[model samples]
Target: MKYKYILFDADDTLLDFGKAEWFALNKTLEDIKFNCNKYIAEKFSSICDKLWHEFKLDEPLNRYVQINYHDLYYKYSVERFKDLKELLDINISAQLLSEKYLNSFSECGFLVKGAENVCKQLSLQYKIFVVTNGLSHVQKSRIGNSKIKSYITDILISEDAGCAKPGKEFFDYSIKSLGTSNLSEMLIVGDSIITDIFGGNEYGIDTCLFNSKRKINKLKIQPKFEIRELNELLGILRI
Candidate 1:
């Protein structure tokens, strides 16, 4: 009952991002006339996961697209195309592939069970916002397609804000946007310990780890609360 603002992570916390990502990536592979054999698709996904992990750590703004494509090419063994122009062409193709994935991903309106109900319930008592580390256009489209859009007060994407999660600047931007100076009255709910939990802790806000998959380890950075289901949040908030 102490928190008046609830900031949520968009991807896995509310959206069923893993399923959406799989569908989008498979669609992209098919569109590019690539053999999307199950094995190949899984391998490409692994490559993407690694690149995203690195991006999260390095926080390089300019190399976002380049790093993804570089990892894709290396993972798919496309480096044999030695001509610089050929490599560039391949990069363009990969970019298009990823763009399609993002586009399709935005259209997929898959939400985790209880996400809508919980958001709606919380909306009555708290100011709710989405804080996500994704491209502005894509994140906007996804929220627009979701049922919880009406319940959320604001959507903050890293691209438009010029900062990503786990950065103090990103949390500061979110706090500023909420029109509040008190950090104790805000709570951040997210799935990633490295980003959302850590970022919220750094910003001196309470945090809830949405560990739906029960995969998080006992980390040094402790979240104020943990819930395996979104519905549990209503009880935590005494809604």
Candidate 2:
């Protein structure tokens, strides 16, 4: 059956997030006069991932927090990276470092190969929405600066959507936002098996696993289709 709407995960699925992250991290390090090293990058990524994991555990995103989400996220990053703190002056706040990283990320508009081609092609026949989970400002800036935004009808970042993926509330919001309850008419495509595939399965929508790395899926959940590249999506849609 043909899918009427396509829900896409923005990061690795369509955008080159790894490259963006690396660029942003390097810029942040340089801006803050911290020595750039692999260890630092890994540590930053690890801390951010851990904080995001914790953040996702709480549903209805807003109800789970007391402080500003960005402040909390940067607070953890600064505290975890003691080296950076030692290097930074006493007056510099962790929030400033976080701001540097995000601004750098916003400046870099890296997209996966054939991302625009696929999205533009799919947008002609199917309503395409970016169902991403990340900072609203950063994600919006990246999309706004990139050509991919032209192919999307709307974007739903978890920060603004009030829920994170793999949670039923997220999908419910998307469905309700689009005024559709027919889950069968939509397809959820993303690189993450745990969030994208599992979320789609749990939400009763068809899942397309964009396994760019061709990694093994240890999860019990199975996607309806798997593609190695963005261009392959066209074939899946039989365009």
Candidate 3:
């Protein structure tokens, strides 16, 4: 393998984030006496997806951005309930809903299939770093509880990094933290075309898109490599 450092995305790439998000959101809504269904889940996910996409584009030092972003997502989620205006009125803060969701999400430990095995095996030959964009506390809790925690050399969250993915600042900070300036020796593997692929591509590093769902690449940018399975990365390293 040519790469000395491997930066792994922690969400859908390694952890089953969709499940965690769904569980946390529904659980939070349940606490507030709201009945949630698949329709609400889908709407919440869509709203969150947009927020995260925007987050990945800019650097915000205030951690309040994370809270406020989630609040906005929750507000949109509440909008789906037509008659719930009376129950989920102005008094209901997005911050409250976000805090509830984070609390519930932190307890989730759903890993993608073969994530631990792949990480364990890769750690032997290459330095593995988890690069993620989310609340530091929430990301830390989930990563700490995951089976692959021991295998990761470090966990870099956007909250602590002062920036998110697709932005060169985050990657630059990561490079400095790792004490390496050789971008050519680093490889980034992630699920997001906008974040993982675009970030690595912009930062001058090799990138591998982990399209577990086999989604087509509609974006103009393309990754150096693409894999449908986590373990398939091992084969990429062999050559």
**Most accurate candidate by TM-score:** 2
What pairs collide in candidate 1? none
Candidate with the larger lDDT of 1 and 2: 2
What TM-score would each prediction reach against the true structure?
0.81, 0.83, 0.80
lDDT (CA) per prediction: 0.75, 0.78, 0.77
User: Quick one: best lDDT, which candidate?
Assistant: 2
Best-first order by lDDT:
2, 3, 1
RMSD in angstroms, candidate 3? 4.7
lDDT (Cα, tens digit) per residue for candidate 3, span 198-219: 8788888999999999998886
lDDT of 3: 0.77
Off by over 4 Å in 1: 32-37, 53-92
Model 3: colliding residue pairs: none
TM-score-best of 2 and 3: 2
- Looking at candidate 1, the ten consecutive residues that score lowest on lDDT are 76-85
Angstrom error of the Cα, residue 55, model 3: value is 9.0
Tens digits of per-residue lDDT for model 2 on 70-179?
A: 44555555554444555434346666776777789887668999898998899889999888877788888888888888888888876676656766667877888777
Candidate 3 Cα outliers beyond 4 Å, as residue runs: 30-36, 46-93
Encode model 1's per-residue lDDT on 1-239: one tens digit a residue.
88999999999998888778777766765666654566755666566556545444334334443234334333332222222114234444544455566678778767889999999999999999999877677778888888999999999876656666776667777888999999889999999987789778877889999999888577688999999999999999998
